[model samples]
Target: MRILHIIHSIDPRSGGPSHALRGLVQEQVRRGHQVSILTTNAQSAEPWMPDDQFRERMNNDPAFSGAELFIARGYGRTRPVARFTWTPQAYRWLRRRLADLDARPDIVHIHGVFSHLTTFAPRLARRFGVPYIMRPAGTFAPRCMALGRTAMKRWFTTLFVAKDLRLAAAVQATTPAEKDELREQFGLNNVVVIPHGVAGVKDAQTDAPAARRALNIPERAKVLLYLSRLTPKKRPDWVIQAASKLLSEYPDLFTIFAGPDAGAESQLAAAIASSGLNGQVKRFGFVTGDQKRQLFEAADVLVLPSQSENFGVVVVEAMAHRLPVVVTPGVASHIYVDASGCGLTVEDSVDALTDGIKKILQADKTELGQRGREYVRQHLTWIVVSEKISEVYAAIIRNQRTRRRNRSVNQQIRLTTK
Candidate 1:
């Protein structure tokens, strides 16, 4: 069967969404399925988007040669970008290319609903009589709108998102929390919960001492690793104040905030200084591959402490590496950890985060990390996620075929009666 996946951009720093897409496309190709991707992020003769626009490069990109890549982009800054995603020029460009759509596709799986690729492509899928799947990721969260920095999205959704969401053959959710959110937001009941999986790195976990040595962390220093972006909605200030309170108690403990600094790095520095927690806080900016794995391995505990998170892919990634996690209240997996005893979840406040961190520091790392990795191995992984997604695609394709056949029969019957 022919399958097409659509996304607006391939920026790796965009994080899990692009990674998940790459993994899915690769697995489908491995399974001998015809898969292609339509992205507004294509490189024309001289690259489509400006060199500065793409903050990160997508490595081992499955969208490269095998997939039929079509480029698309929204003009202007990312904040007010959703309007540009569905601009008349982009819409016309897409319609023209889709006129010669490669295989007419059995299904189109859309990632990031607000992007140019999804905004216009879904309408095309609908017009071409194909099923389209919507994966909003965490964009449906209210705080997403707050962070989207867009008053335009509110109006855009009323016009496009609402209709596109309903017309979608099914909405793909990464967790039950997201499915519920979708149902509440758009009255969209046709939602499927299919959480993402991380392909874990073997021997990723490093002993605290060795990790500290590698990172130049002083001997006897305890590390609390925050392995994600420095973004406003993540509330890194909570982590800072929390670490400040725990500082005296855990004499050796130091906070390592790592990840690409989109905007919050200086704010974090200022917060740490104003809170009188200087020197105790260290910012590594962004570290991936070996550094990322070693940092997680070396930490005493993994702190997410997000105000609003969809699934917290980092939480599960930490689990896969057998690191105990302390997530903030709004993360979707907080309840899972709370129920399963995998780790702790608390409100996004300095006091609560501090307490949770201390609790994790005291917990049995061997047992807890072992349990966490076991649970992740049993439940999460790309193979399982891909299988579930495959099922969704198959069901959609089958339904479409059945509908076409039924319509044909009815047309024949009407003609006979005439």
Candidate 2:
């Protein structure tokens, strides 16, 4: 299958959608499918690069090997417009590709909403008689819609996104709760639920002692890891508050805050200082590759106290690393954690999170971690997720063919009658 993906940004620092797209595309390519990506050169706060350099970097990057990448220079560097991803070059490139019979995609997968790619890509695909699927990637979650330029989002949806969504062959939701939100909020009935998958599960389990030594962490200290973008919505402060409460009880307890500062770094730093737990808590900004693996290996439990998450990919990553997780109800993966009995799902409160952390610290961590690993091995691996996504693509293509046949038949009958 020739698959095309359109996303605003594929930079790892941008967050979950980027990481998810990388995993999905890599798996699809590994399965011998032709995959292509259209994206802008938006790498968080970094200065935008020219298209040629961006393409060269992406093509050479081992993470995206075996896939064709198209990069366009994008504009805007501030809030509201930062994610707009206005790329006329990408728009023109997609238009030309759709117009070319040889280059036309069998299916186009558009990721995220409220962006130039998501808004315009679907329209182009439809114009060329190609089917496309929309994956909102939690953009339509109630909490998300309520936060960050709510009025503008509502306006954009009504004027452009709603029609784009309605015309999509299908809209993907990473969790059932996100599906429910799509149905309830937008009245979209074509939503399909597919969870994000983790890659490299077998190699995820690293040597804990070695990792601890590398990070200069005490071998016997109880570690709680908060690994996600330090955005306000992620509520890193809540984790800090919860950690403070548990530190005295578990003197050996250590908390590690990892990931890029999205907006809440100062607040989190202040919280840590005020709580007087700065000695017990450490902030390691934006870890990736081996450093990320080490953090996972050295941690006892992963904690994500987000205000909302359609799917916490980090939660699954922690699971893949044989690390038990403590997530709040706002995290959609809480259902899986609860169902799999791999971790604890606590209410979205500091007290509840503190107690949940304490419980995990007091409980059999090795057993809990093992259950998480087993769950990932069985259900959350990219090998399994890609298969399900392929099925969805095939089903949509088949339905499109049937619709075309019916249209052809109806035209023939009208011509005969005339």
Candidate 3:
């Protein structure tokens, strides 16, 4: 099947949605499906100035090798305006593809909401009679809706997004909670639940000693890792406070904070200083590729106390590395953790988070990690997820063809009767 994905940006720093899209696209291409991506050249570091090197690397990245990529020049530097990502070139490119019989996509996959790409891509797909699936990626969740320019988002949804979502061939939700949010917000029944997938980890345990040495962490130390964007919603400060409580019990405990600072570094720093965990907690801002893998290898457990997470990809990634997780109920993947018996799901409070971390520290971590790895292998790998997504795409396309055929048949009968 020919699939086209439309997203605002492909930059890794743009967070989970971009990374999730990359994983899905790569797997789809490997399965022999033709895939193409249309996105703006918008980087989180400098939105107005497009990074030529980043685009070059992405084009050459092995993960995206079999897919066609189109990156249009984007406008707007500020957060609010930047999201609207004025990319006239993307509009033109999509228009041409939809008009060409050979170049037109079998289906279009639109990611995220409240972005220029999401706002306009579905409209074009509908205009060209192409079935399009909308993946909200948790934008409609109550917690997400409360963040950043709520009024503007409200207006945008009412003016444009509502129609686009309602007209989509299907709206994908990564978890049942997200599915509920979509249904509640839109009063639509076309929601489909499909979780994000993670790549398998190889020799993560064998590499732990070397990973610890490289990071200057003692082999005997018990490491707790916070590996997501340091945003306020993610609540990295909660991790710091929780760690402070465990120091007396676990004297050799160390905490590692990974990922880029997204407006929460100051709070995290203050928490570290106040708790006097300056020596115990280390911040490795924005790790990726090998560095990220090493962090997973070195850590005994992973914690993500986000106020709301549509799907915590890093949690599954940690599980793939045989690292147990402690996440809040707000995390959509907490259900998987609970069901798989891989980790604990606690309330969104410092005391609860502290107790949850303590339980993991007190239990057989190795066994817990093994459970997580097995669960991910069985149910959350890219191979499993991509197949489910492919099925959805195929079903939507088949239904669309049936509808068109019926319309054509009815039109012919009317003409013959006349």
Segments of candidate 3 deviating more than 4 angstroms = 45-50, 201-205
The estimated TM-scores of all candidates read 0.89, 0.96, 0.97
CA-lDDT, candidates in order: 0.75, 0.88, 0.89
Model 3, poorest ten-residue lDDT window? 42-51
Best by TM-score, which number? 3
Report lDDT (Cα) of residue 42, candidate 2.
Answer: 76
| Inter-residue clash pairs, candidate 2 | none
Q: Rank the candidates by lDDT, best first.
A: 3, 2, 1
Error in Å for residue 167 of model 1:
0.9
RMSD of 1: 3.6
**Mind giving the per-residue lDDT tens digits that candidate 1 earns over 37-130?**
6665433122234543542344234345465554544454544453245445557765664566564677888888665657777888788787
Candidate 2 clashes: the total is 0
Which scores greater on lDDT, model 1 or model 2?
Answer: 2
RMSD (Å) of each candidate, 1 decimal: 3.6, 1.7, 1.4
Which parts of model 2 are misplaced by more than 4 Å? 46-56, 203-205
- Judge candidate 3 against the unseen true structure and give its global Cα lDDT, from 0 to 1: 0.89
